[model samples]
Target: MIASTPRVTATHPSLPAVFLLGICALLNLYSPQPILPALAHWGGVTVGSAGLTISATTLGVALTAPLAGSLSDRLGRKRLIVWAITLMVACTLCCVLSTSFHQLLLWRFLQGLTIPFVFAVTLAYISEESSAGSRALVNSVYVAGTAFGGFLGRFVAGTTLEVVANWRYTFVALAVVELVVLCGTLFLLKKEANFTPSRSLLAGISGAWRHLGDMRLLLSFGVGFLLLFQQVGSFTYASIALLHAPYNLPPPAVGAVFLVFLLPVITTPLAGRINAARGPLFTYLLFSTAGAAGLAITLFGNVWCVLVGMALSCISIFAGQSASTGFISSHCQHDRSSAIGLYLSGYYLGGAAGAIVPARLYAHFGWPGCVVLLVALAAVSCVFACIAWRK
Candidate 1:
C-alpha cells in the first residue's frame, strides 16, 4: 500500500513567518523597478535598455521556476527558501558593486535565478499547511504582504536613488534591507510538518511537467500572465510618462506614485472574502473588469484621473491575482507547488515581457498606445477567467 504524505495544521506563528517570507520575496523581486530611470542615466542606456533590469530578473525566475518548484517538493520548502534568500543577498551585493549596465544585468539575472525558489514554494507551503476553509483568507493575507513589499521596495529604492544620486548606493541600501529581512525569515520560519519529500528528483520534475496538460491550470496561467503584463507594463511606462510631459514629475515624485500600491493592501484580503462568499469565478470576472476599467480610465491624461486609475488598477490586479492563485491551489490537490510555479512562471514571464514591450510602445506610440495595449491584455485576461469559470 502507498503511504500518505504527513499533514500538520498551521498555527498562529506560521502566519507571520509566511507574511515575512512574502515580503522578503517580493521586495527582492521588484527592487529595481522604481529605479529603472536612474539606471538608464547611470549607465548611459536608453529607457528600453534600462527596462532590461526588470526583465532580466523576471526572465531568470521564469526559466528556473519549474526546476525550483520540483526541488522544493523533493527537498523541503523551508530549505529552498533559505538557499534562495542566501543567494539573493549575495546577488544584491554583486549588483551593488556592478560597474556597468551589462554587469548589473548579469547580477540581476543571477538574483532572478535564486528568488523564484522562495516565491514558488511559499504559496505552495501555505496550500499544504492550511485547511481549505481558511486557505483563501491566509493566502490573501500573504498576497497583501507581497503588495506591501512591492510598495516599500519601489518607494524606498526610488526615494533613496533620488537622494544618493547613485544607483549603486541605492542597491547597497536595499541589500542591507534584504539582509535584515533575511534574518527574520530564518529565525521566524518553522519546520515543514505537512510536506513529504518526493521519492526522487525525477519524480518531482515529472509531476510538475504532467500538470501542463490541465486546461484549467493553463487558463489560470494565462490569467496570471495577462494580469502581470498589464500591471508591470503599465507601471513601467507610466513612470517614464510621468517623468516626461503632461505630468513632468521628477524621479522622486514618480516613485511616490507607487504608493497607489497601498490599495492592494486592502483589496487582497477583501478579495479573499469576496471569493469565499461568491466563488473564484465571480471574483475573477469582477476584478478583471475593474482592472480593464482602470486601464481604460488612464487614457484620460488628467493627473487625478491617472492616480485614481492607478489605484483602481492596483486593487483589481491584486484581487484578480489572489482569486486565480486560490483557484489553482484549491484545484491542484497534488503537485500544487509545481502548479503554482508554472502559474508564476507565466506571471513573471509576462513581467519580463512587460519590462521591455511597453517601453517600446511608449517610445513609438505614446501613452495612448500603451493604454490600448494594456486594456487589450486585461480584456484577454478576463476571457481566460471566464474560461476557467466554465471549465
Candidate 2:
C-alpha cells in the first residue's frame, strides 16, 4: 500500500482548538434549551422570562466578549483561553448549584463573558496560524464544528434532563464536558505564551473604539447584528407560534425543529467557498433572503411554513455567521482578536436585542408582527449586502 502524507491544510491546530471551542459553546448555550419549561414552572415566569436565559447569555457575550478578546490579544490566546475556561468552569458549577431564578440568571450572565475568547480569539488564532490557502477551510471546519457542538450541547441538556430527574445533573454534565475540553485544549492547542500580552485595558478599549469607527468594521458589525437578529427573532417566536393553536406540536417536536435547523450547517464549507469567491455580500444575501422568505411563510400559519422558515433561517444564520467572521478578519488591520471581539459582541448583542423586540410585536400583531419585523430586517440586511458587494 502506498503511504500518503497529510496535507498541511489538514494539520492546523485549529481543528482541535475548534473542538475545544465547541465544548465551550455547548456549555454556554445548552442549559436554557431543555430546561426552559422547568424554569418557567420553577419560577412562575412568563414566556418572555423563560426566554431571558437566552437573552442574558447573549447580553453577557455582547457586553464582555470584547474585553475577553482584547485580554487574549494582550495576554496570549492560550492564557486568555485558560482563564475563560476557568471562569466558565466556575460559572458552569454555579449553574449546577444555583437555587433560584436570580441565581441562574446571574451565573449565566457571567458565563456569557467567556464566549468572546472562544469565538473571537479562536478565530484570530486560526487566522493567524493557518496558511492563506487553508484559512477559509479551517474556518469552515471550526465554525461547522462549533455548530455541531451546539447540537451536542443541546443534546446533553435535553437528554440529561430527560434521563435524570434532576436538572442539576444537566448542568453538571455540561461542566464535565467543559473540563474534558479544557484538558484537551491544554494539550492540543499551540501555546501562544510567547506573544506579548496587551497590558492596558485602556488600549484595548481604545483599539475597540478605533476599530468600530472604521466604516468597514461598522458595516461588518451591522451584518453580524442583522444576521443574528433575523435568525433569533424569527426562530424564537416561530417556535412559540407553532406550539400555539392548531399545530400544537409537542415539546419534543419543538426540540426536533432545532435538530432539523442544524441540518444545513453541513454545507458550512460550501458557504465558506461561496464567501471566498463571490464575497460576503452575495453569500449573505443568498442566505438571508431565503431565510426571510421562509419566515414570511408564517403569515400562512401552517406547519410547512414553520419547516420552510427553519430551513431558510438556519442556512442564512450558518452561512452569514461564517462569512461575517471571515470579513472581519480580512478587513481589520489592528488587533485581530479585538476586531473579532467586536464582531461577535455584535452578533450576540443582536440576540439580546431581538429577544426583546419580537415579544412586544407578537403581543400587538400576533404572527404578522413577527413576520413584518423579520422581513424588514431582511430588507435592511439586503442593503448592507449590496454595499459590501460593491467593495
Candidate 3:
C-alpha cells in the first residue's frame, strides 16, 4: 500500500505564520504590477508587454510548481517555504536593479518559480492540520491571504509608483517587506517531524501523477483552472481596461477596481459553508455560471455594466470555489498536497493563459472582443462543470 501522508490535525501557533507568509508573498507578487508602467517607459514597451510581468510570474509558477510541490513533499513544507522565500527575496531585490525589460522578465520568472512552492506548502499546511469542520474556513483564510496579498501588491504598486519616481524602488520596497517577513518565519513555524523526503524528486512527481490518473481528480483540476482563469483574466487587466474609456481614470483609481476582488473576502467563507452543506459538485455548477454571466455583462462596454459584471464574477468565483474545494478536501483523503498542487497547477496555468490572451484580445479587437474571449472561456468552463459534476 502507498504510504499515507501525515496530516496537520491543528496548529494554534501556525496562524501568525500563515499571515506573515501571505504578506511576504504579496510583496513579491505585486511589485511588477505597480512598476509595469515605469518598466514599459524605461524599456519603450507597450502596455501588453508590461502585462507580461504578471504572465512571466505565472509561467514560472506553472513550470516549477510540480517540481517544487514534489520536492516539498519529500523535503518538508518548512524547508521548501523557507527556500522559496529566500529565492523570492533575491529575485525581488534584483527587480530593483534591472535596467531593461528582459532583465525584469528574467527576475520575475525566477520570482515566479518560487511562488508555487510557497502556495503549495501553505495549502498543504492547511489541509494537513485543520479539522474537517474548519478545513474550508482555513482554506478560505488562505485564499483570503492570497487575495490580501494581491490587494496589497496592487495597493503598494499603485500608490507609490508615480511619487517614488524611480520604479525600481517599488521592487525595493517589496524586497524589504519580504525580507522582514522572512526573518519572522524563522522563529514562527515549527518544522514538521514526519517529513519523509521522497527517495527522489521523481518519486513525488510519479506519485502525484499516478494519483491524478482518476477522472474525478482531473475534473477538479479543470474547475480550478476555470475559476482562476476567469478571475485572473478579468481582474489582472481590470485596472488597465477601465483607464481607457469615458472614465479615463488614473492608475490609482483603476486599481480600486481590485475592490471587486475583495468581494471574495465575504464570499469565500459563505461558499465554504455552502460547500460543506451542499457538496462540491453542485456548488460549482451554481457559482461558476454566475461568474460567466458577469463577464458577459462586462463585455457590454459601459462603466456601470462593467462594475455589475465584476460583482457577478466575484459571486460566481465563490460559488465555483466552494464546490471545487469541497471536492478536493472530501475526495483526496490521502496525498492531498498533490491534489492541491494539481488543482493549483491548473489554476495558475489558467491564470497565466488569462494574463496573456485576454490582453491580446483587448489590444487588437478592443473591449468588446475581450468580453467575447471571456465569454467563450466561461462557456468552456460551463461544459467542464457539467461533465465533472455529472459524476
TM-score for each of the candidates: 0.90, 0.89, 0.85
lDDT of 1 by residue, 1-391 (tens): 2125443333556677777777776786777776777788889999768977877887798999888888888888887888888888899889988889999999999988987788879888888777666778778888888898887777778778778877787778877777776777788766676787788889889989889998888989998988888888888788778888788988767777888888887888889888878888898888878877877787787877788888888888889888888888889877778888899899987876776788777878998899898888888888888888664
Q: Candidate 2 at 47: error in angstroms?
A: 5.9
Return the candidate ranking by TM-score, descending.
Answer: 1, 2, 3
Candidate 3: regions farther than 4 A off: 1-11, 23-27, 193-199, 236-241, 244-251, 296-302, 318-326, 358-369, 386-391
Runs in model 2 lying further than 4 Å from the true structure: 1-10, 41-50, 192-201, 297-301
Tell how far residue 172 is off in model 3, in angstroms.
Answer: 2.0
What is the C-alpha local distance difference test score of each model?
A: 0.81, 0.74, 0.71
**Which pairs of residues clash in candidate 2, taking residues 3 or more apart in a chain or in different chains?**
74-197, 74-198
Q: Flag the better candidate by lDDT, 1 or 3.
A: 1
Candidate 2 per-residue C-alpha lDDT over 1-391 given as tens digits, one digit per residue, 9 for 90 to 100: 2124333354765477665675476456645777788777877787558778877777788887778667766676777777788788889899877888888889888888787777788787776665567766677767776667777778888888889867778878888888877887787887652244455867776787788678767877887888777777877787787788878998788877777546654877788777777877787778777777777765776888778767777777777777778777766656778888888878777866776678988988877788888889888867875776467
| Superposition error at 21 for model 1 (Å) | 1.4
Q: 157, model 2: CA deviation in Å? A: 1.4
| Residue 292 Cα positional deviation in candidate 3, in Å, after optimal superposition | 3.1
The local distance difference test score of model 2 is 0.74
